[model samples]
Each structure stands twice: as C-alpha cells, then as structure tokens.
Target: MQELEKKEFERLLPYLYKRKERCPTFVFAVLERFIPGFVFADDLNSPKTIFVGTDSGLYFVGGPISNVAFNKHFLKFCSSKLKEGRRFTLFSGSGGWDGLISDCFRLELKQSSRYSFTFHPEEYGVKEVQLQEPFTVSRLDEATIRSSHEFNLEYYERFWGSAGHFLDKGFGYSVIDGETALAGECTSIFRGKVYAEIDIYVDAEYRGMGVAKKAAQAFIDHCLKNEMIPCWDCNVENLASRKLADRLGFREPSSYSIFVKNQ
Candidate 1:
C-alpha cells in the first residue's frame, strides 16, 4: 500500500488530460484544482488499472477495496476518517466503474451516478433575453448566500451541493425573486485552461422559465473573464436536462451510462 498527500496528487495530471477532452470528471477536476496532482497516485498494486484521490477525504475508482486494502495504513492516510456528511464525484469511469469502487460509501455512489455535462465557452453565446417581471439575477455574495433558499437537500447533496462548494470558491450568480431561487448557476471548475463547467439548478416551480440556461451563461461569461473554458452535460435519457444543456450550447462530449444497486 502507498500513501498520497493533497498537494502531491498532480502526478495524475496525465489522466486528468485524458479524461478532459471527453467528459470532465468532477472529483478529478476538484482535487486537481484544490490540490496539486503529484499527491494523487494510482494504487501500485492496481497499476494503470485503478486510481484513488486523497484529500480531506479518500475516493477510489480503480479497484475493489477489500477489507484489508481499505484498512491498510497507507489507504487510511488518504481516505477520509470522518464518515459523516458526504462526498461527491463530477464525471468518471465507464460501465465497470461501480464494480471497481464497491467499497465507497453509498453517498459517494449517489453523487457519481449522474451523467456529466461538458459545455464550451466558445460555443456559448447569450442574447439579452429578459426575464419575467419581479425576477432578477444578482452576483452571489455573503448577502446573496443568506438570501438563497435550496428546495431539496438530496438533489443539492449530490449535484447542486458540489456546485455550491465551487460557487463559494469562485464567482457565482443566482436568479431569485424575494429570496426564492428559481434557478442558479456557478463557475464550478476548470479542465486545464481551455474548459470550464457550468453547474445549474432550477427550482421545480420555475421550470421552463429559461432561468437555468440564462443563469448558466452568466457563469460561463464569468469563467471567460477568469480565462477558463466551460461546458454543460446531461444524461441522454434526461430530456429536460439535455434540453437545458443544449439551450446553453453544450453537447455530449463522450459516451456515458448510469448504474444503481437496489439495496
């Protein structure tokens, strides 16, 4: 067993690039952004086969974590000891990724289960589409943070929750009326200097209002000002999500499939 540090994960930079041109893996991008890649490493026993991410938490994608493997001190060092809240995955592996990470918590699995959307800045252009009266979008700030109301914890926990963290990191904008979040988006993360991601969410009552698409473009513009790229991705079967991504000029960058276990 081997150990890795948060800042030392950049050694896995090559894998980040390999996955970037395709779908952007959320965890890979998050760790890469939050820490250096030298700290990230492939499990030597697993080789070019499996990989793991270490930080305030430990996430695995390459191999099955047998009791011995998960308990090893080396593994202990990278994986999170606090098993309370939850962690998330952006975009990731193929048909077999779930089998490879059976030891990961159900929460982590829930976070990674969604298909990723990758949107490009050059492909995104916004017209001055006005919103319905009594609604407006403002920059996210301390006040805005307090003003925003999230409707669902589970959806936010997995998808929107990750976006919220990223929003707190960089520039984010929200659409609201009287403190209600009709829809919102943030400049989540960068895949190299060339690409960025727009994480958007719309309230159930506010669907079809273009709140998601417009707010998403605002975040994309913000990414451009910061010298990054952005994209949106969604599952093919998700008609609404796919339509929203398409409205914002995002297309499927690669193939993706979803998995779930009926425990």
Candidate 2:
C-alpha cells in the first residue's frame, strides 16, 4: 500500500475537477489521497487499489484507476473521527463493512432533500426545483486541457492520467458545452450505493438558467440508476452552495471545519 501525504497530493486537485462554472472539488481535490489514498490487501495480486475521502462519502480507486476496499483500522478510525460532529475516514481491506466497518457508519444517508442530512429525492413536501438544463460533460484530454490554463505543469501532468485512473474506478464527466465540463456525481459502484459529491459549475454566461443544478441532477440520476447514493457536503458558511444543495435535495449531515495540522 502506498500512502500519499496530504501536502503533496492536494496540489493536484484543481485540474482533476475543472469547470467553467462552480464545482465541488474542495475535499476530493487535494485530500483525495491525503492519509491512506491508496492501499491493497496482503494478497499483492488481489488488485491495485486506492481510497479517497470526499465531502460526501468515501471513494475507491484501483486496478487501473482505483478501488475502495476495506482496511484493518477503518472502524476504529471512523469511531475516532466521529467523536466530533463531521469527519471522513477511508478503509482498505484491513476492515470489513458489514461486520465491523458497518458498525462505524449508518446507511450513508438515503437520497433526501432533508437539508439537515441530505438534499435530494425528497424535501419538506415537494421535490427540489431544477437549477438548469443538462448538457453533455466530458474530460479535457491532458494535452488539450493543459492548453487551457497555466497554474502548474506538474498538476496538469497528473491530470493527464487521473481521468483514466478515476474513470476506471467508476468516476465520469460530460461536456457542459463543447469545451467546458460537468464532472461526476459517480455513475457505478457494483452495489446499490448511490454516492456522489457533486460540486460542479455553470459557465458565467450559462448561469441563472439552472446549468449547475441541471447538470447536478443529471449526475444524481446517474447515481440513482446505479443504486449508488449521491451526496453533497459544504461549509455552513457557504450560503450559496448550501442553498444550492438544498435546492437540489442534498441535506446537510452536519458541519465542521478542517484544521491544517501544520498550518
């Protein structure tokens, strides 16, 4: 198992989930590989694997992209992290979800619009209103996507491989227009586990017509189709984002802040 230190791994976040509009790339961006981003069972030939923490839920990567397996200390760590209100922990083959890991988690929240825990499928009484019309989303190839910005070369280099890496693990994206993109709310996960940490953007010119919401619902539907839970998490202070989540039926499980151990 290879661990990606938080500091070095976070720097590669931006390009991973790029958009011309608002998106949820915060937690998954840099923290994707924070503590135990990648790990494998003792069976070296079992499968190459990785795990990522998202604002909403945990993600897996492996055997080409990444996969989310179990880890030994997962339940113990989940217990510790949860002593507080909100937190995330990844589990590799070290633990089991049903016997032990399940003890540390609830049913990962059902898709509801009860903003206190979720923001989808249901609401006070009615469902959420649409935010925008959906458009096809896609990943900009590294060479092509690289030409779009000039923040860091190393970042783009990692991106060239990440789409394939993440895609193989069930992550996907679509083109908002032709150039811009509306990325994953996660499409597949083998089980009826609808999970998606949707943080996407609508181009400035495309705002006010429900571009973001439209694309997000589309992504959410993708999760539903696969039976994966689609979820969203945002800073309580991010009123706009919070409202958007509520509008889309993503309820807040709780709110908390992350402190940089060194910062």
Candidate 3:
C-alpha cells in the first residue's frame, strides 16, 4: 500500500466516511502527538477505501468501496503487510474486507458482537466493592508504569507501550499485589473530549477475584469526576467482560466485528 503523506492525509479526510470508534481515533491522536511512524493508506483512484495501521491492529476506514479492482489492491497490500508482522488484527466498519481476506487466506473468520455500554455510577448501587487485603487498586501513574515494565516486559509490553501518553491524555487504574501488577483498567482509546474507551487486562492468576471490577471502578470514578463519559466495549461472547460491564453500571450492549489474523 502507498503511504499517504501529511498533506495527502489531511486532504483526504473530508472524502472519507469512517466508522465512529474511539480506539482508532486514539491512534490518530497518538500519531499527531508522537509521530510514531503510523501509516495510512488507500487505493489510487477514487480512494474510497483507506486504513491506518498501528502495532496493535489495522483499522479500515472510509467508504462504500465496492470497486473490484480496489479490493484486489487492498488485499495484496494487506497480505504484504501481514507478512511483515506488525499489525495482528483487522478492524473494519463497512468495506467487506473480512470476506475478501478470508477468500484469499486460511484465517478463520470468527463472528462476534462488539458491545458498547454506558456508565452511570448511581445505577451501580451496592455492587461496588472496595479492594481489600492482598489487593490494592490505585490510579496507574508513571511509577507504577515503570514497575510494570520491569515486572514483565514481554507480557506487559502491549499495555506498556505509550503508557506515558495515555496517562497524560486520559487515565488508568491498576490492581497491584505488592510488587506485581495483577490487573489493570485503563483508557485504551479516546477522542479527547467527552469519550474514553475502557480496556482491561487481568493476569491469568488474578482472574475472577473482582480485581478488574475494582480497577474499573477507580477508572470510572476518574472519568465521572473529570466530566468525561467512560465506555466499555468487547466481543459479545466474552461473558466475563460483559458481566464486569454490568457490574460497573454499564447498560445497553451493542455489536460489531473485528477480524483477527491467525499465525
């Protein structure tokens, strides 16, 4: 795929019809602030379809790209990128690339609903549980971030990359067990105004202990205090996550699909 230069990127914005999501938008925000080598690309003619790829995944943005020729180019470009081993997942709103990619690759096309829930602390009622012994839930700051990096570099790298950036732009809460970070609830993606999407990471050993819920509560409280609304999203089949959202007073789950690339 041909990369779009700054001017080309800006000029193409008005013509693009991207899906409304905070995560990918957060990538764009990070690109603007850090210039972290993020790439944006699209077809040459009409340029109806486009995407932005980061370390985490590929985000398909813009258009009713029904053109056959463009789809083929898009496929070739993505396959090449996949071989390069940077982006691991494909997230699209409308381009029908899921089907196109499946037709060419052996990857499994798993279907799941994307759930978006709203936050209302008052509705949480008595379900809120404070962290007790063996667990300390607190706002994740620079110090904790460093400790986490030192604790487990390989596993925490996903959550640790650009930690400072996210901490500055939004907020995060971590469940610490003495020295180890057991679980965390952080603002994964945000639009810098009224919305921030929540992403949680709980160590396998700490699952089902209400650690995620506690950390999430801390994050939700921060958002409410700051006049920002917190959003929780996940695959519908993720029952535990759905339950956690329910516990945090999030209502009205929604659905969407993201294509995960298999190795």
Clashing pairs in 3: 114-255, 114-256
Which structure is stronger by TM-score: 2 or 3? Answer: 3
Model 2 lDDT per residue over 1-263, tens place: 43455555544334333422222222343245321233222223332333344433343221222222345443344555555555343322222222333443545422112122454465623343343345454433443333333212343223322334334443433334454443222221121122345545444566666555655656666666777566565545667667777776666455322221111
User: Across residues 172-248, which tens digit of lDDT does each residue of candidate 1 receive?
Assistant: 67787655544654534333344555556666777777777667767777767887656565555677777666666
Off by over 4 Å in 1: 19-25, 33-40, 43-50, 53-92, 96-114, 120-122, 151-168, 178-196, 257-263
For lDDT, candidate 1 versus 2, the one ahead is 1
Worst 10 residues of 2 by lDDT: 184-193
lDDT of 3 by residue, 56-150 (tens): 45455434557665566667766777787565566655436545555676554343347667677678664667666767777766676676633
Number of the top lDDT candidate: 3
Worst 10 residues of 1 by lDDT: 35-44
Residue 185 C-alpha lDDT in model 1: 45
lDDT for 162 in candidate 1 is 43
lDDT of 2: 0.40
Task: Provide the RMSD of all predictions against the true structure, rounded to 1 decimal.
Answer: 6.1, 13.4, 4.5
